[model samples]
Target: MTTRFLRSSSVLIGLAVCGILPQLHAQSSPPTEWVDPDTGHRVVQLSTEPGSESLYFNLNPFTPDGRKMVITSPDGISLVDLATRSVEKIVSGRPHIIMVGRKTGQIYYVDSKTENGATSRLVCSIDPATKAVREILKLERGQSVSTVNADETLLGGTFTERTDWDTNSYFEGGPNRRTEARTADQQRDSKGQLMVERLDKHYPMGLFFHNIATGETKSVNRGTDWLGHLQFSPTDPDLLMFCHEGPWHKVDRIWTIRSDGSDLKLIHKRTMIMEIAGHEFWSADGKSIWYDLQTPRGEDFWVAGYEVSSGVRTQYHLQRDEWSVHFNVSPGLTFFSGDGGDAKMVARAENGKWLYLFRPELLADRSDGNLDTKGLIRTGVFHAEKLVNMGKHNYALEPNAMFSPDMKWLIFRSNMSGATQAYAVELEKGDAK
Candidate 1:
């Protein structure tokens, strides 16, 4: 089932044709809204609690059988049956013991808790059906978990600390031991042989892969660099995609590497924009990736995509004043969350109130044999303006709205209930908006 979509010339192309100051169409559009089936109401409030500040979802829950949505909560991991709205707790907040696997019909996470500023870590698992708990690893001193990848096989965590020092013994100078510690008075003054204690420790800052079936564990070395996000290739477990502190520089870049710690490659690097600043996702087919790149200005940078195979990239530009639309659409376009395989839907808010939906096929003709910059800007603006007036509809505030493995259901995290909870929407040809 298909519908005719629109394609508008980019603000850039329109200007380039006239050949002026480059007329950069650096603006982006809002998200496309998915209409709620029941009450002509655009929003399907899934959470029962509302107006609760800080009640938000970080990751989109995964569906084991594409029928039930599994998610990690502050307490632990939980599963919600998409068809029935039945939620069963896999594990409660043990704070430092989140579960992190699900191949055997369960949920998993590594729990980390801070007590008086120190962290304790643990890896745990839970049954989706009966809600029973099982401990995988107990928190050892100085270890903290960060995120669990799509494959339960991998887990990311941090091991870090700091040190302090004392100041004295430079001006007075003189004891035999002071000579050994401070050297000559000139040397002491020049080198500042001040009595200082060296505080050194190694910290973990990455995702690790644990073989649940084999009991084998391996770590991804991000060294002393900041590891922002990590994902295993959907097609190959031996391959991985991650974002880290740019090599030799302070900026952040998306990279790919062989899981065995070889053949590391910078899949995409931005020169003008350095810090990634937010979350990113790999395409369902692992052919492309997406993330938001900020400019020197305070506005959120454009959300951009990179094609893994062709070396072609696409970016959606929105004005800093259009932050509402860009933020809303950024996540939807980055990931897929629907039952149908032929077409995908992405929604973003233009002004916090209005939303837009875009279909890739809508601008297929403008591909230019690749994802051209002109095509992206033109199509994005066209969709953003049209979606704003789609009556009243509420898209998921969280960027995730993906489908189960079988594409039989739509799984998304929602805060319509005030508290963020997992919910599902059925997909059909008629449902496309």
Candidate 2:
């Protein structure tokens, strides 16, 4: 059971009593409540587990049926059934190892446990309702699956030897040294410094893909020293996406290749005008790509999309005053949300941190774009609130929050009651109030 305790408004009230400020005199932490400005109605919370949390911000983590959401917690990989308001535990696995089948609605995960006293990792698919496990691919000791195709027939994994390294050798927030440590193919300088190796130009470290039906696996041969952030488009069985996996300005960040390992195309190439762009994702229809772009050192923030077939680039520039490194579009492209505070999601210029949602129509809006200064989010909801455990403020939940399949709720992770839990804020109908 969650350790219940008395709600404390005394701390903020004491500040007011000390003549610090009168504004927080009545400002105890409010419950999850936000009224729709359009209808004057309020949303409701769904998930209740104390330590519950959902998938990464970029990954949707929703099953095909839309009735359940995959969540990982101290317990295991579980499902939040929106219809019944119940959580069903599926299997025990590490967070970020779970996947929802795009076509079959099956749950897939990397099963790493001991069998007959021998430990191994297996890429397995499951029937969430029946808890039936089917092993599709067996991984090497260091290999881990990161992405699967729309049909779940093609999958990709990354293998590296630098799992143990002083990752912050270069800059404060540079990418981890996920590349292999072997220097067999590298030439040392006169000073005995290792030359920079570009794996995308030549694949040495294994960036491999496996075909489940044919039992064939091969290295696609297009990656950097470290490859990560793999994603398969829901509309194309042959289309797969991967990243160079490092800080911006290092190299081109995103690339798309066919499942058969042909037509390897660069999605976003950094240029002088637009210095860097990454955090790539597929649009709902798979006809285009969605990503965030900014000038060097995190300025000129812009949310951009590129049409895959037409080669069209559309950018909605946010005011230079506001900033966020990561941006995610809703399933229907109705609105997009931006967040900062994580290492990869920092706001280089902002004083504090926030998670803001914006209507698509208001993205480039010069009139009311400054939500932080305007007060109460414009275009849609302005949720500057955070959820975290009470005593341990630093153990704040990553509100990898996103819109539900039907766009009726804003789902996120919170530890407000002392445990990191997944919670949802419902979007009521226009006339509900």
Candidate 3:
């Protein structure tokens, strides 16, 4: 499929989501195009690859200029030039790292050995222009969720000793490493049964800060338990966040620290009323941490935000109609989007996965109850064109949808054609949208 269009139904957002908003219709700039009834935005598909398209959620797929895209597969790393619609293979095998420098436009990826093997991992930076390769950091431990600072002078990394099967975690309790141990080392256990049973040791996961210019890698902090979802603050280059990557109710899901490793502090702790907060992301300006708030049993679904400096929090509660796997805010900070509602659509179906946008400003007077607002809409529903067992594994394609840095477009991955490829949808302007 080169491109297929989806028109908004004359659905009432208030009726579907319990009086969340008034009746709204899609206002498409191109009259023939589909306008999202929720946000009144246009949606477009940017790719139709025949094989498979994969992307990491923490990393922004767009390069410095948004002219190129980066993706990976079992075959290796591939680059897509958005303007020319071309694909270039950068590496042969799946690397340990895949990232794009925000300011320098340097393509950074890693080549590594298996976790049980005694080999070093190489973190490489490639100049997209010259295709020159530079090995920046070499270490015995593997890195996950590594990202660059806003200015690109430094890189933040999370190094965990847990032997994981898949890094792109969208679900839990499938082919569990601890229970389904493969190696002799995995059969044994240490203090912790599950993690130590999977690996020889349960060393504390280390969070590192690497200076690009100085060629120095410093250990900022390390934890003995599960830790991941590490990300650098967009506005504050020296600050970063990590979490105990487990059930939200079992652990404090959000924490923040500095590059020098000092001032290590927890960002959010669950209270009796608000018992969980995970799937966290920084605000556009880095002033607050935005996340979904819920109870232990997954009731009281809410889109929440916390001001980092003032310790004040604001929440916009959505009706308990359906649940979304993740929620992301636009760079403009005017709307928030969620996925996974209707479950009937297959790879080609867009039923349960709709592009839901909610406005927080309209709920200014409310804090912790069902939000009564008008800026709610379902702009689009996403179902992959085709589904494939990537790498011949149990994993299937997941649409890690995100807004562009400029917030003018939304980026998502799917296998609508034969292959998985990156796709973009144009957004309407502030006034007309």
Residue-pair clashes per candidate, as listed? 35, 6, 11
lDDT of each: 0.42, 0.59, 0.58
In candidate 2, stretches whose alpha carbon ends up further than 4 angstroms from where it belongs are 1-45, 93-96, 161-203, 222-224, 320-322, 340-345, 349-352, 362-397, 428-433
- For candidate 2, the TM-score is 0.72
Candidate 3 residue 329 Cα shift, in angstroms, is 1.4
lDDT of 2 by residue, 1-433 (tens): 1101112346546776898755543456434333344334343345555555677666657888788888776646788776656778887745245478888778777766687999877888888888888888877744667777788888776665444335322211112111234331221111122213323323334567788899898876543356667778878877887777655566678888776668888887766743878878887778888777776546566777777887766676665433444566776677776544432233444332444565555433465654453322223222222221112212223455577787766666655445555665544332221
RMSD of each: 17.5, 10.6, 11.9
Tens-digit lDDT track for model 3 on 323-359? Answer: 4556677765676765433332112222344444455
Candidate 1 per-residue lDDT over residues 1-433, each given as its tens digit: 2212212336435567787424333434222233454422222223222211111223334444556555545454455554454556555654332322334545555555567997755566666666676666654443444444446565544333323212332221111012235433344344322322111112334445555556666665656554444556554556677665322124445777765668777764545543343345566556666655455324443556667776666665544333331232222353222111000111222333323233332233555666556423222322222222212323323324444444433344444433444443433323433
Q: What is the Cα-based lDDT of residue 87 in candidate 1?
A: 54
Query: Per-prediction TM-score, please?
Result: 0.57, 0.72, 0.68
Question: Which candidate number has the best TM-score?
Answer: 2
How many angstroms is residue 155 displaced in model 1 relative to the true structure, after the best TM-score fit?
A: 3.4
Instruction: List ranges where model 3 is wrong by over 4 Å.
Output: 1-45, 113-119, 142-145, 160-202, 341-351, 364-396, 415-419, 428-433
